[model samples]
Target: MRSFVRVAERGSLSSVAREYGVGQSTITRHVAELEQALGVTLLNRTTRRITLTAEGARYLDDTRTILRLVDEAADGVRSATDRLTGTVRISCTAALGVRHVADILFAFQDRHPGVCVDFRLSDVQIDLVREGVDVAIRLGALSDSSMQRKQIGASRRILVASKEYLDRHGRPDEPGALARHAIIRMSNVSGSDRLVLHRANAEPSILPVGDRLLVDHGLAARRAIMMGRGIAPTHLWLVNDLLEAGIVEQVLPDYSPEPVPLSILFVPGRARVKRVRALIDALHGALRALPGMT
Candidate 1:
């Protein structure tokens, strides 16, 4: 049915075959089987093109509606089931995946061995539908309002540097002084060229930042800071361990960037899947347990 729908919509058997990653003969056979089952000619084929017969035109609309309802029914059944069992495709930033999400996934897998997880860790934002991702863990503000979101916790970005770097370069006394210090910039996020600092009951301060080093991954930026390359703004959770161990210290402690919201995003109907719902619940609980997460 999916193949037929694709063929009808695209108006080419070969195109549908490529979309499905199957041979053209397979798509031809699928349509042939459907026609045979229905005992009616659904499409008129010429040497160069295929056109839907009148019967095919009417059937196509009904088929699309049927397919939609079928999917909804399956989702409903999955949502009501007690046992969660299926593959869940998830995407998250590389730093968060390495530092935190991996452990949460392991624990969830341990509890529900029947569930399989396809985890893709990258800094680039992925299209949930196009990428077939069931869930995405996003940090900071969400731009796509189409996806359903559940705020799990909050993450604050703060200026941090290695003790060695601080001792040598000296800490900035205020937001304005940051211009004199070398800055490690995260290339993946927006506003890397500027620092916006906020404090309680005070107007926000903005200062242009110089990029001494730029990295694509948060972990890479953190490494640059720890190597005494420069000071960088980072999520508090990412550097919490290093802070406790006296490896790195927060700079300009009096001011911090506005806290970025941490959220789990999914397609509208995806939350109805049992496996997705289970994972979301597990992740929410895990994130709440982390230090400095609200």
Candidate 2:
């Protein structure tokens, strides 16, 4: 059942075999034997890829639930004689993971020595169930309504550039002046070509800005800003230390980008597991305490 669930999620028998440190033939036999017992085909196989059948798809959901319940039961039994033990898998946005979440995980592991962490970092939104991820630390507005989420904080974004760049290029006195200066943009986000700024008593200013360089990651954009490349609107958490050190200065200080919500999303079944619950509680508190997360 375990092997089948992994094979279903990963879509490859060989990959599951490698993960289990076994031969592909062994995994093939396991699936074949299971199918024989059930008298139903679970997958459609071809030379290049595998696809789950209609029945298989339904079975997959039930199988995952069964596996989760079994693990929960085992953990409940073990808690009587041992310290908390089990792996907690987490997925987080890349920049935040590198800057803060990794440190939080280290501290968590230090406190719960028997617990193991499987951490994954990516800027792209991934399907939690398909990837077998227990929880994801996400930024920006969430679109999925069905998933369980806990809003930890909000990420405030602001326009910023290094002093060296502004010294040579001059500062913009108004939002309209941004068109005359180079801007660094995040390529993956929609509307990277524009800046929307807000102030206390005035209407929001939407300005078109030309990109001098395009980067997909927050850290890359920060490096470009540090190298005096161009001005960028960035999450404060991504560059707070640099700002404090005076390595970068806020542009158009009175105006700011709309703050985006930061949340921890989890699979409903997985959140009930003890280790997963513990990690989520730790992260909710720690991430809320990060600089620029309000």
Highest lDDT against the true fold, candidate = 2
Candidate 2, superposed: residue stretches over 4 Å from native: 53-55
Q: What C-alpha lDDT do the candidate models reach, one value each?
A: 0.84, 0.90
Mind giving the per-residue lDDT tens digits that candidate 1 earns over 165-251?
Answer: 989988889887777788888776788778888998999998887756888988888788789998888898888999999999999
TM-score of 1: 0.77
Worst 10 residues of 1 by lDDT: 75-84
List, residue by residue over 1-294, the lDDT tens digit for candidate 2.
888888998999998898678999999999888789889999899999988999889988898889899989988897897567888889999999999999999999998898989899999999887677889999888987778999998888999999999999999999988888889999988877788999999999998766569999988999999999999999998899999999999999999988889999998877888889889999999999988888
The candidate that wins on TM-score is 2
Q: Cα deviation of 48 in candidate 1 (Å)?
A: 16
